[model samples]
Target: MYKRILLPTDGSELSHACVTAGLEFAQQLQAEVVAVYVAGNYQYPLYVDILPPNGPTEEEYQAAMQTLAESYLQPVREAAAAAGLACQQVIQFNDSTAKEIVHTAQEYACDLIFMGSHGRSGLGQFILGSVTTKVLSLCLIPVLVHRIKHH
Candidate 1:
């Protein structure tokens, strides 16, 4: 009975699988979908003298990241359109992926969060950290994680 579903995608194959699953669920429930992409803010060292001369400025890097994020969100928009479901795309610029996802869901009043897990285990997860895991722990709304099996 979800009226609004929030789908966070990183443009990975696994995430696309989650998008398809989320769309199917939304279609079944006759709900709308909000797809979000979180772009991490580019951080540079405070010592400008150590930077490369050809490196992009902070504004340029941010713009490039936003463009890439829009490209990543395009497929979700098209899929939702083909399914004839109401869809909205949001591009959030923040360093914390999990926080942005949860914040967007709450800001939009989404009833459910449908996301994909990277399937990292043991030391990998511990060392790299998982955004899905963080979202699960922090989000107030129900989260449906789609785990893709890699053969």
Candidate 2:
């Protein structure tokens, strides 16, 4: 039984399925749901050369990121509200998605994390690996991965 469930969404269809599954688990356990969106930080060394000297100072860039965060997590928030579960949203800019997710779960004291398997494979898997796999390897809390079949 979980008291708090952490759900991460990336605005993808599979992420939506993960949110739905998380909601069902939260409903069954009478648990609160926390939705986290981890934004990619552009400060990495490889990207340093590509960024302007000041970096992302444009209002449009900031606004776009903000809008993205809100829109992406909005459905999850609504689902939790409809289910009568206490819900909160978090946005973090980080270089490592898996690290951020694991950290957020710990910070929120979540008993469980429900996520989607993005199902990357072949060259893509070799190049990018999987965030779910990395999180599963690093996390301490219980992880329930909803495998969303890729079309």
Candidate 3:
């Protein structure tokens, strides 16, 4: 029923597995795929009084993030090509990964978001932060979280 699907990845093996499954699902639905990598924005060091002489400049940070994004999204691109599925790739920077994911979905008019969840619960989720939980709470579109049991 969905026309477009958004897949967000952090380059982990689990996320890549999710990407493969999500692409398969998109192929079944005859939908286009949007692969997005949201990197955290560069933050200046907190010590204003004692500034470090050697820190990444904003431009340097952007370049590094871009390189990292390409690394993370390369598999997605290759998978989409192999599946002969139409794919759009996006790179975004934001403090909140979940918000960026939802925004990307809305911006691309994606009908569904298919992403991996680490299955953190209760205290673990609260301490480590759960993007899946945040996305489920904030997103208006459908979210299908793929979880793989880890040994």
Candidate 4:
């Protein structure tokens, strides 16, 4: 009987599928939802001399990421509203998305995390490092991984 569910999305097709399912489940439970989107922070050097002349400044990069996050989160908001569920949306810019997700769950007092996995295996998953896997490793709360098997 999870009271609050955290749905973390990356705007991928698979992620959207998970969010949709999560929303439906939350609707059934009549639980509050927390939708979170994490954008990567700009980590490159900010010195003017070391950067390209036409390259965006750190502030510009941050603004762009924030805008992107808003776009990614908009659908979740609309879907939650349609489901008549209470949803809290959060946008975070951080290099480590898994950490941010765990933090958001803890900060919001979410009992469960519902998120998607690309279902990669072997060399690809090894090299790419699955954020979902990392979140599973790090987070204490229950995580329902919606593993999408692409054909």
For lDDT, candidate 1 versus 3, the one ahead is 3
- Whichever of 2 and 4 has more TM-score, that candidate is 4
RMSD of 3: 2.9
Q: List where candidate 1 sits over 4 angstroms from the true fold.
A: 49-51, 120-129
The positional error of residue 53 in candidate 4, measured at the CA in angstroms, is 1.2
Local accuracy of candidate 1 as per-residue lDDT tens digits, 35-117? 99998887886787798787888999989988988898999899899999999999998999999999999999999999876
What tens digits encode model 2's per-residue C-alpha lDDT throughout 121-147?
455423323888899999988888776
Candidate 3 least-lDDT 10 residues: 120-129
User: Per-residue lDDT for 124 in model 2?
Assistant: 48
Ranking by TM-score: 3, 1, 4, 2
Candidate 2 pairs with clashing backbones? none
Please give each candidate's TM-score.
0.88, 0.82, 0.89, 0.87
Scanning candidate 4 in windows of ten residues, the lowest lDDT window is: 120-129
How many residue pairs collide in each prediction? Answer: 0, 0, 0, 0
Clashing pairs in 3: none
Off by over 4 Å in 4: 46-48, 119-129, 149-151
Instruction: Give the root-mean-square deviation of each candidate in angstroms.
Output: 2.7, 3.7, 2.9, 2.7
Best of the two (1, 4) by TM-score? 1
| Candidate topping TM-score | 3
lDDT of 3 at 83: 92
Q: How many angstroms is residue 120 displaced in model 3 relative to the true structure, after the best TM-score fit?
A: 8.5
Give the Å error, residue 7, model 2: 0.2
